[model samples]
Target chain A: MIQQKIPGKPVTVTINGKKYRANEGEILLSVAIREKIEIPHLCFEASLDPYGACRLCMVEVVRKGKREMATSCTLRAADGLEVLTDTPEIEKHRSILFELYLAEAPKSDVIRDMAAHYGVTRTRFLKRIEQGDPLGNKCVLCGLCVRACSEIMGAGAINFINRGPYTVVNTPYYAPSRDCFGCGACVRVCPTNAIEMEDVGADRVMKSWSDTRVPLSQCECCGRYYAPRELSASVLARLDTPLKEEIARLCPECRGKQLAQNEILAGRGGRATHG
Target chain B: MDERTLDAIIARHDAPAGRLLGILGEIQNQEGYVPRETLELLSEKLGVRLSQLYGLATFYSYFTLRPVGDHVITVCMGTACHVKGAVAILEALEGLLGIKSDVTDDGKLSVTTIDRKFTVEIARCFGACSMAPVLRIDGNLYGYATPEDLPVILGEYGWTP
Candidate 1:
């Protein structure tokens, strides 16, 4: 069993006049959320590293007669620090951030959830034109896929490229990457349904977090979907050098069948005969 | 407007998180960094404490405690950039400037080393992946960079080789 580290020292902090003790170095937001303090957050995930990009976890912290607004995910507990999870200023900032995210990626359920919770339905900003969305704007630019790929999976198959306003995540050469493991971790972490799994009979097409099409494959045996076309081809190439026709003809099950038939024909037929 | 008026405006208006970041960003833009005094004033007017304010400021990578230089040099360390030897280029810059990421040179050139910048930050693939090892000085993008090109790029920016 993998050992999990329990915090050695516990620290005391006050939230809205209520005192709570938590482990040192633990994120203030996670502990507050666990304690049911109703701290608003949008870009934080327990499974992944804290990305303060969304700026939703802003809180008021009072320490030694000083007060300031900060993101709870990246801050640690300090002795005698007083925290306020909700205030008009914090609420206002969170609402506007949600609006900006909405203007960019209006169709995200995660954004919708935060909007509903925060009582934000409309704003003064004009509705942004859905630039890349074929169906509609869905991606919120949360960086989950990038973090999962680089930090968790250890395969830097994809990443954000370019600078402001025109940045995009892509493989090297804009061609299919050789490093992807077909894990679909990016697809799973997307906040917007912009990234989709398209099942095309024998193939699986993956839409990017921003709705760019990344064609994947469907296993022939169970018809389960896999990763991008280039990734699948590379994986198959590593195992054996099969002609395209041969590969197309054999799914996992059919390939197993071909191997069994070849074995039987090679005088390993005794097992078949017994059966 | 004076500090009192600025504090009054922050207190009177009910700004959301994005607007707050924008407001704080504006303050940073004006002052070159978010002053501790400004944060304290915001907290007192907004009824929040100092620790909470510091938490928000430190949480996002964009907010900086120290002053930055006039020009910002951001080197892309994304996978494509890395594969094409972005590390070497970054090392060259560090060697030349005697500074690291998030630090400005004594001459006031702020250099930030990031894997990705905003906008294209959420891109599934950088379309210019063909141009591996890219760098962006301010907003201008350069591609297919080598260690040899570093001196030329810096020299163009008035940095001697």
Candidate 2:
């Protein structure tokens, strides 16, 4: 783990033979990722918990005379821990995983791009490509979408059902989802375009490979759909109290225009009011 | 902390609208690091978004989510310091205390010791090129420090030989 922050006390850890100070308990992959260290991972997000499901961020850790290979995302940047990110052995192990990922989604840009980055031109392993959501989904199931919906958006609209390789993300009971707000929060967080959104009149439907559709709201001002009706209404209702009710009816761009107009007026004249 | 204490802490600030920095400083000063629970408490009490509060907390180097040690050890690794053997001096200190550098990890300025006794930190430069290879131990500046100067200096701070 590398320590970049120079705050109160800095702990030092070695990465690729160079000593770097890092914060205690920070994920090692984040250290490497931030420095453009080229540790391939799909399940890693700074905002979310360090889920080591990707298995791509493995690094050789030499700490206090013990050598072990550990997932960099789960590993803490403790002092005296020496991490070797790119070695022949580490790369060999990583290439196997990358190769497997490619076989899973040969058309997947995620695996293909990363494999290209790591120089994995081809995979000898036979493609046991399992079927996934439409648009050649290529969803590696990093769980970022599932976590984001429940955590960030506070909407437990979509989730993973079943176990093992048969597991797929879906709303409860694989139904059309009456509970879904059409927020498309899951779609926004999806690693792959497996979850897609389309506008149909006043409603915008977020579609997944499971054939589930979530309806959303169309922007009133621009006649463009932005969010689910419930979410939009809630946000507008909140803004109305402290802000102008007219601003609530307008979309973000219009609101920006209104603010910009106010700014220009204020700049041109003193105490300018839109009304 | 209890809600009453948190309420009093909020009361110390002029208002609940924009005293986030002041409130964070006060909380950090009182409790070694800002607790997430405290942040949630502040969010509820102050009506500030949790995300906004987190932005401020992580942006400022002074604010730490983790507890730091009593003594702060700062080494200069700026271009001038590097030419002056700052890396060697830092390595020597690391060898002495067994604290490694994690600069590649958090992009933070410092990393505290595991025992929480010391925080081994680094800075680019103190604007003192002449005094290259400088490091500070508990606010006291040591210029032109060599690998040989470590154990003896650390001994002065009651570091066991």
Candidate 3:
């Protein structure tokens, strides 16, 4: 008896005339990205859901004799879902989008390099450069950091404040966020590396969010401050069984060494001493 | 509103009409503005994020986060009203309140007096173009209002000083 290992009926999607196997209802952008197809995207994070705010991955879907443009990140895969990644219309759209991004985040080398890759080096739009911007004037306002913090970390520390043209992502009242776990999920998920975080002494300073400081946990063995205390505590709480008292206070590297030592000692039928 | 009153309001809205907007609207109507403490309490009680509530409060012009004055003076700044010296009326109210119109960092619209006696604001329109340069104080409309009519109209609302 043949069994399907993956969920969703296997469907082949044609991208740039090459057919690739994917599950039905899977994101088209995910399929294109997995198959090494050249589709430029910014706001798509594998951990978080597709937001489609960047509009960089616009692809043309052909059905019968008609064509429709849609964001590949939000587009779902189905059988015979023929799509062109770099059609003339998509190129024109990408060129204008790159120009807009260039103007929006002029200080970002990531944007400049990516734009130059697609042959868009100049923009006619007025450049926006705020003096002493905490995000280093590189934020494209893609909401990836905001969404990652709230959705992934359950922090909900930052969000889109104000409205319309004045909209910006930051802590409430632009004050130091009391709820930030200092998990660095936002810094990791930021497509343009707009979020700034640094561990200063005993506290992790979220410089972008009004210098929000979260306390760092000191390792028992190394006596070095490693992770945020709250974040470590939260992660420990999720385990089925709590770690041993001595092992819980050590950092990841030290903890791994201690666990391996304990395994060898247990095999030798001897009690292991806490290093 | 006190914490108890806020709890009661949330309890009342918690059942059939537990929508966040409706609950916030009720708070605005009762308290003139949604207080930060009240929003925090609402976030905890309703299991909604504080940022989400703050976003909603700031997005809508009807909801204000700061404490408003006892008497709210709203001058319409619609196209018809602006043509008829609406700016003059707003300036007059600012002068009467002894406070300059300052836009805060959060983009809040209304400006309240220092003593918290009065708040002057601008509205897009009241849809009463026949009464161009219209002003409303405590929900009472003054049609065809002038800068000169402010002191007298405010006097009626216990602004004798």
For candidate 3, the TM-score of chain A alone relative to the native chain A: 0.92
Question: 2 or 3, which is superior by TM-score?
Answer: 3
lDDT (Cα, tens digit) per residue for candidate 1, span B1-161: 25775665575456575656665666666665677668767756665434345545544545555544545566776777777787787777777666564422111224432422211111122456688777776557778888788778767766654
lDDT agreement with native, every candidate: 0.63, 0.72, 0.86
lDDT of 2 by residue, B1-161 (tens): 67787788889998756689998998988886788789778977877545456546765666777667877788888999999899898788788787787752235656666777777888877887888889888779888788998888877777775
Indicate which candidate wins on lDDT.
3
Q: Kindly list the per-residue Cα lDDT of model 1 for residues A128-217, writing each as its tens digit.
A: 554554325665566777677767776555665433443445443244444455567777776665556555654443444222344556
Instruction: Output the better candidate (1/2) by TM-score.
Output: 2
User: What is the Å distance of residue B152 in model 2 from its true position?
Assistant: 93
Best candidate, TM-score? 3
Q: Encode model 3's per-residue lDDT on B1-161: one tens digit a residue.
A: 78788877777775555389888999999989998888888888888888888888887888988899988988898999999999888888888878888666666568888889899888899999998989988999999898888889988988865
Candidate 1 docks at the CAPRI level of: incorrect
DockQ of each: 0.02, 0.01, 0.56
Q: What level of docking quality does candidate 2 show?
A: incorrect
**Candidate 2, residue A56: lDDT:** 87
Clashes of each: 34, 45, 0
Instruction: Provide TM-scores for the models.
Output: 0.48, 0.56, 0.87
Model 3, A1-275: lDDT tens digits are 12223668989999988899999988899888888898998999877777889999999999996999999998989999999988899999999999999999999988998999999999988888878777888989999988888887888998888777567788877788888999998899888888899999999999998899999999988888998998877777776443646445888889888889888997798776543
